[model samples]
Target: MLVTRQKTLRRFWYPVMPVGKVEAGPQPFTLLGEKIVVWKAADGDVVALADRCPHRSAALSLGWVDGNAIVCPYHGWSYDGSGTCVRVPQRPESNGLKGRVVPSFPCTVRYGHVWVALGEPLAPIPDWPEEDDASYRRIDQFYETWRCAGLRLMENSFDNAHIHFVHRDTFGDIDNPDPPQPAIERLPYGFVARSDVPVYNNELQKKNLRDDSAVTIRHITARWYMPFLRRLHIRYPSGLDHIIVTAATPIADDRCQVVQFCFRSDSEADAPARDIIAFDRRVTEEDRAVLESTDFDVPLDMNSGVERHMPSDQPGLLMRRMLIELLAAHGESEHTRHDAGRATQEQKSSS
Candidate 1:
């Protein structure tokens, strides 16, 4: 029998939602694999707490905001920005509520996103170079949960060899293709991968390479963040400049939620944007089918019995191992003990 994993919510910062979505009042989301409620105080500070209301287990999200406090709808219990129960309508003249505090987390709204720190929140959120520009457009998109781990799913984006088989006719042609040799760089926070593979564009490759002509190189730069987030920057100068892809994948053990932010340059055609959207959705669906059908509940550690590597998979392999070590050292092991369904149900009822 498979044993449930230990609960270690602290270790990394979690991307909850876009800053604008969390209104002046109480807003709730899932972070660090836990359901949480956030509110913008009158002082302009963002407060986050476990969504559970200590009183009768009602969701704090259902509670209305009065000044900087969140007033629970059930029996009227009020919690301050710090998640402390300040007032109990049913029992006013009592000092018993002095130490009644909910689980509160450190949070910040930066670069159009609301991030919650599961640990001490020692560092700033990862910076995207284009986030500050007024001309940059941000589009938030999401995909259904994947059975495989988030890190594994993200590595698929960095793997050029998979394109030949996984995306085949649509985004690549692997049937009669030349081998792919990728150039990789290790950055302080993440990694950058690029390849001059002619299969980067299916249409153009067929036109130029069909006659043994030279094809252009496609520079695919993927900036990865701590835990499991990848900000992809793909530039084909003759193709498009401002094409970017950002994803936040929070793993609930083996299952993962892949949230994507697709940003386009102020100068690209509308067709590429549309194609990117369709291509991502289609390929992700294909991946979901493959992962779900396989034995996805295998161990997350490197020793788990799975058919393994080649030169092309080196970058992905190193990244996965590093992530595993990072999580272990931080005390958040790769195991799923948290019930995501319960968390979602609680949020919906409370919100």
Candidate 2:
């Protein structure tokens, strides 16, 4: 069985770029394997449309933004924010072409990122409560591309067991390789995984510590939403609260772009954003080094027994199952079936 990529993953909103990046100029982006151009309208709202010009198939991104419309460089054809071709310089009398339009996507700007839906969004864009909370200060926002599949990065973000081994140099301790079993709470949209974990604070975190005493226990809670959104909350015993909201947008089947926002309730007035971003970059880089080298581009099918699961893998397991369910609900489960069949065949051949 095979499934079209778009059908498998079109119902979710993807963060394509930072809101500031798309100004009065056209910026080209790819989402769900489709080329799109985003620009700011004269009213300052964001707009997204197919990147190609109808006249010459030239990339609209190659052209410039004129007020609220995007002008094609090849033929001086102009398109408005709604994807309507409003002008054709060569044919001034072409009134019949007013109805000619290019493809347009639903775009929304939130959390400092521009989000576009390739298809009708099944739900509203996911949100983090801490983003607007008065107690929590938004500190850092960073973006990076990973060479692994979006699911891989998402699973890594949800995996607590990997910290001891994969991040030993940064924040993990090799001697303590075991983590407590996480409590999983299933929700209508997704699930929440909660556990108490010991954290080894880096120098930057140490500086922000409210208490200088050597306390390592922190309450960790991770909330995962349907396709690829996650919010991780870390509460210290010293009344310091930290949150990380991560959205992994699929760039291709084997690649993704991740936007991360870090927030803290303590020391917001003094904590340096660069230090926090640097720490996150280091940890994500460590994960990227391993994820990019993995053999599988896509996540393993949870129902298939090819991959082993432990108590600590509950969150990732639930995530994979939920993703499979979403794809099936969207009538795109052929890919999942194909993957499972292949895995079964590989196992049988090996045995």
Candidate 3:
């Protein structure tokens, strides 16, 4: 059941952290509600595995790395990067040492972060900021924990309505009653929205401080891979030369972890990368507060069927509905019956 619930996050490789974060030791973390341990072998390969030792169920991360193998702290049992049990202390004659292996996940490092696919590979992790594009520069990348499902958070980020209201102080004006209505247009792979008005009152918007008249627009692209893995592209101040924000959100149900990478022109050497990170974190915290306030205790079925949506909510609503249809068709195949249980629980509660 847990495996099925994490299908989307597992099937596709997800960037967990910058490559520098996980060194030569076992780093324990959780994703999609499953406890996992990540470690870099001496050979520079990254490995992610279920954290528990197969023998005494001790945390594998509590052990030490012996060469390319992880030595369990409890009984000296060791497992290799492929999760194969390579050694067992004082058990040379035992058959358990032969093919016994631990569950393992595949991992790779790209764009400066470590990525792990929770399950068998569904597809190669797509490259971003496409390699040949000299106009792009790696601005920032990091992980954020939200006490809300990743789906809701992603939708909220792409949501056009919240910009005019929830972000009135930073991204919108205080008394600007006549905010320019956003225009959303569908893109080949996802969607885009544009506005030629200044919606933010931030440092970037102050007339003497920066170019406040720079038309602020946001272009977004969304692709869902189910069990809650989403790829989103957000480009701000449309018509700029590839100033793009790409992110992947893996939903761990009520809590989601997002890995975002921001890009700017490579020639723009004067851009302050840390400042951009701080700015994004500020907006993200605001979004986190709003998403976490939803009635999560309510069952999924009730939340699914008993909600009212405004006209401004169309884009998010459509995306969610499309996900629902996709899951209904592939849910069982993906072994995501637990989501159905949650949905049914909500259905009954709503009744």
1-351 per-residue lDDT for model 2 (tens digits) = 121253756777878898888874789987767889998888887999999998879999989988878899898999988888888887888831667479998999988889998888887887678778888788647687776667667778778889989998777888888877788899877888888888787776676664454437878888887677788898888777878888788776666778888788865455667767777778888988999996434544765665677877777777777777877676765355456578999999999
Candidate 3 versus the native: TM-score?
0.78
RMSD of each: 7.2, 4.5, 5.1
Q: Write the per-residue lDDT of candidate 3 for residues 150-269, one digit (tens) a residue.
A: 557556655666765677656765465444444666542245555444555377433212345534554545444333444445444524433334343444555656677666553344
lDDT per model vs. reference: 0.62, 0.78, 0.62
Q: Ranking by TM-score, best first?
A: 2, 3, 1
Clashing pairs in 2: none
Give the lowest summed-lDDT range of ten residues in model 2. Answer: 1-10
- Candidate order, lDDT descending: 2, 1, 3
By TM-score, who's the top model here? 2
Candidate 3: residue 189 Cα off by (Å): 9.3
Off by over 4 Å in 2: 1-8, 303-306, 336-351
Each candidate's number of clashing pairs is 0, 0, 5
After superposition, the stretches of candidate 1 with alpha carbons farther than 4 Å from their true spots are: 1-9, 24-28, 42-44, 93-96, 176-179, 200-216, 267-276, 294-304, 331-351
Model 3 misplaced regions, further than 4 Å: 1-9, 92-96, 130-132, 174-198, 205-210, 214-251, 266-269, 297-304, 331-351
